[model samples]
Target: MMPSATRTDARESGVIGLGFATLWRGIREQPRLFALAASGACLYTLTGVASSIVLGEATERIVLPAVRDGHADWPAVAVAAAVIVGVGALRALGMFVRRLAGGTVVFRVQGHYRHRVTRQYLRLPLSWHQRHSTGTLLSNANADVEAAWNPLMPLPFAVGALIMLVTALALLFATDPVLALIGLVVFPTFGWVNLWYGRRVWPLYAGVQRLRGEVSAVAHESFDGALVVKALGREEEETDRFRVHAEELRDAMIRAGRLRGLFDPLMESLPNLGILLVLIVGAVRIRSGAIDVGQLVRVAYLFTLLAFPLRAFGWVFGDLPRAVVGYQRVEAVLTAPSEEPQGTRNLTGPGPAALRLAAVSYAYPDASPDGTAALPGTAAPAGTASPDGASQDDAAGPSARSERPVLSEVSVEVAPGSIVAITGRTGAGKSTLAGMLARLVDPTDGAVLLDGVDLRDLAPGEVSRAVALVPQQAFLFDDTVRANITLGLDVSTEAVWAALRSAQADRFVAALPAGLDTHVGERGTSLSGGQRQRVCLARALVRAPRLLVLDDATASVDPRVEGAILAGLRENAGASTVVVVAQRRSTIALADEVVHLDAGRVIGCGRHVDLLASSPRYAALLTAYEQAARAAGTDAMPDPDLATEAVS
Candidate 1:
């Protein structure tokens, strides 16, 4: 379980510090852009004060004399109008620069961090990713990064507002001491009101931001599993689930809005109230001749000009906490530990890389020591069907899996150019072990080696060039078949044809409307399940990996087609070692050797026939598989987790 609101509050005290620290980091990294923005903001804000001063001068020199003489002073009025226009022109120029520079600052920082987050996502180990929701990660890279930088657009303007306030205060004092005192009283109250408002809105803002990620996560999950949701008649349930999150997000934003509803009124009134006070007091001072109407006008106008700046400050005060929360979230990914340190060691001469798993043990990070996991709401590993209520996928948000080790200390070996099959019941950890052979994951207790080089020690990209794992579930991008198979590789058309032939996909692909150019649609939705699986195979085969791990990659294909594919793999194994996670008896029989597992341990390792003859447990398992196969009438596409229906 995660921490509660009360606990998060302990960190809330540092929210302001976090926001400024991020601001400082951005300034240091992109100094020129921010400086330009600040210069522009100062120019405009100061010109605002200058405009007030010019108005006072115009009133005293032109208006008062004209009124006294009952005639307009045309030349003086023209000069004053020109001066005001010049100041206005300067303000416009400043506005242009500030807007241009401030926009760059916001986008550049957001782009920089978004790239960092994405690269971090690619570089982080699969295990690290499993701990987070895809939606949350998306939110971090997109929405959170955007939120963290939203205040930047207003930040420079706010800072200039500060300078403007100070300059205006000095001018007010220079103009009239009594009027200046009112500003002194009113501005501090503005800060105090903002401070109070910020404290109230901070948590609400954080909640709103967090809920955005929740909404994103739920939406992504629903969309990604649309088929399952619709097939199971779960559309209404999914909608309800989404509505729950959307409503929560709406409620949170409303809460923040309600706080601002009060805060904005108070902030606006302070400046206007100052203007009123100055007017009432100035009327008396005018009668006594202590201060003139022009001086009072400048003071009241200064108060009026200050209204927007006060609101700007209030905006920063209100927004900084949310920015802090978002930055904290984005930084979590940016600073996450990268893939385990690389090693300088390289693989020795490699043809078909020999595989070795020496007492390899793996426990899902939060699994019980004995290899049982008990997480309640884990997402199943992607290639599988429904979650089956498996807690192991919690390895994604991982504590979602149930208690039990996925793999215990299991040892296995595969010679070069050989076909080995990993067989087990549903939870027998077949896919987990195959993943180790290909270095998809590291073993907790032992090591996986390729051509006698510890996979971890081999230089990066070396293993990938030599190994490929095609899991039971096939995934395809929304692209042409050629693009999907080559995946941007510059492979010769001949080599691609040969791979397609091996996977039994060339004929179907050749008949498509545009042949290899036909768009597959997202996740290969345009193709049948078997065709998708075969296309995935062609993708891996085209690479000609030295070792290929198929975690039941042919499950959906016809048994006859699967047999031909197996024959092709056997021939291909002459140059590339093949590891198949299998449930089909025919698939197992074709293997040169089979490793049988129960629970998380390898219980048998030998030829399929030998295992059935020697180990009753293996015999019973296969017999049950055969019975399930007969029942399904699908040529022994056995359910790895089916109850043993055959009496031994």
Candidate 2:
């Protein structure tokens, strides 16, 4: 849902400017089609004008003269009828052309805007995505785009209405100026009624659009969390919540309908009233001998013709405000600043991948200066210099003051082809560190280096190619096992098997009914937690990234399976550097070095034994890990207090 302030701004930003700009862009996109449609509209209007003129001429020349002379001019009457028939046929053809071209324009415009919005979603950063819900974004691409272009559907009719009204009024005045003067009152009245209607309806329509987004959001949440809702027996609560939003949407739509209903009747009646007024005035003028019966009849026919154009004019004005609001919403997404800035440099030379964090620190936008909790791993101890010997104060200046740092003034380096383990309590910023290593996000302060080049300096694609990060939650598309593992890579089946084997996932996959061809359900729901983790691990392994950062990726796997996976990684350690965010001692035992974090600050970094001897915090943390593991019936450490006793 759009913020109230944003919606207010959209409403205030003159609909004509945005609406015309949107129309102009659509025209520019398909100039030939738009031009053809406009020409058809012109042709259709002129044909209608011609038909009316032919009717007036037929009445004046043949019908009226024959009636006065008391003798039927059959030949002249037949010629006039034939001329009317010909004009009617031309008008029908013009209508056909106008409708065909107008429909094509509507489709093209809707498609063009939808495509642009979808592309913008892809280009936007994860941070931006975090701020908006999936349902709102979907509505922006689909419903909003549809609403924005809806005015185009009746565009040809509206354009022709303007032409018809102007031409018809000019002819009416020429035939009987006194009747034309009274008929013209309808135009100003129609304008005033619509102007009043638009103001009243704009807010209601905007509210309806907003409520639509809210309804979509609620539905999406309910569906996505179906399992949780059912398991927790919260279905009634969820249903009630959805019902509230639906009722609000219903109320908004009904209110908008009522306003439209009132306006439509007024618009329809006003034209009929004009026709009546014209008849009364035309009769008076006819008695005064200022105009003939044929002229009076023609002027009345022209007023009757105003009905179609006037209603179309009302439709155009009535729908314009909603279209403008929808377009502004779409434009907001298209014009938002890209979160991922392009980098100019490339990562060329490399052995495995040398990783470095130089004074790297990050903070959430709302974090407090006094160091309330921030995004895990972004805060640093106050006044501490980075591991690479850079000061945090120098690296992050005034801009950093507003942010609550998640990782603070911390730096660490891992040599090529080495395994380093990161361990911290929940919210210790373990995952944030892994994210920075993979360049999923940039540090608010300092830099992350790959092969001695700042990660930000390398193109995003280059960084992606060099680093593979398997987050704590393993997500898989609903695709075949082989496709999930390969993920569009041009790797051989043998390579795939090797990667699966390394992640300890091959045996189960081979046993499946279709082997590698078996489909994994959304997020791999058909698989057990361990199976899903292994599949995700295989996905990363198959890429053969120079640097692999695993954020507790193997937590669900059996200890024996995790050990095998770690051994496999160790065997290939010479070709790649491995960074594991681990809590299990079995996993940490395999790492050549250990980095322990406390409250987003790196308190110690060394080999496990070295840390146990020198850092009391490391030993205490290890004891906590052992106790938790024992409680969970998985004791990777046989001696829980050994490290603590050694330190003492």
What does candidate 2's lDDT look like per residue over 144-230, in tens digits? 888888777677777887888888888978887778787678788888897788777877877787777668778887888899999
User: For every model shown, what is its TM-score relative to the native structure?
Assistant: 0.91, 0.86
Residue 117, model 1: Cα distance from true site in angstroms: 1.7
* Candidate 2 vs. true structure, TM-score: 0.86
Number of the predicted model whose TM-score against the real structure is largest:
1
Q: Write the per-residue lDDT of candidate 1 for residues 1-648, one digit (tens) a residue.
A: 112542364366555666677677766766899889988999999999999999988888899999999999898888898999999999999889988999999999999999999998888776566555677778888888888888888888988888999899889888888878999999889877876775667677767777777788789889998989989999999899999989988998998999889987897898899989999989988999989878988888889889987888877777777776677677667777754667778766657878888888777655333321111111222332212112231122334334556778898999999999988776777777776766667777888888887888888888778898887778899999999999988999899999999999999999999998999998999999999999999999999888998988998999899999999888767778999988788888889999999888999999988998999988777778777777777664555455374333
Q: Report lDDT per candidate.
A: 0.79, 0.77
Highest lDDT against the true fold, candidate: 1
Cα lDDT for residue 422, model 1?
84
Name model 2 segments beyond 4 Å from true. Answer: 1-13, 61-82, 367-404, 486-494, 513-517, 613-616, 632-648
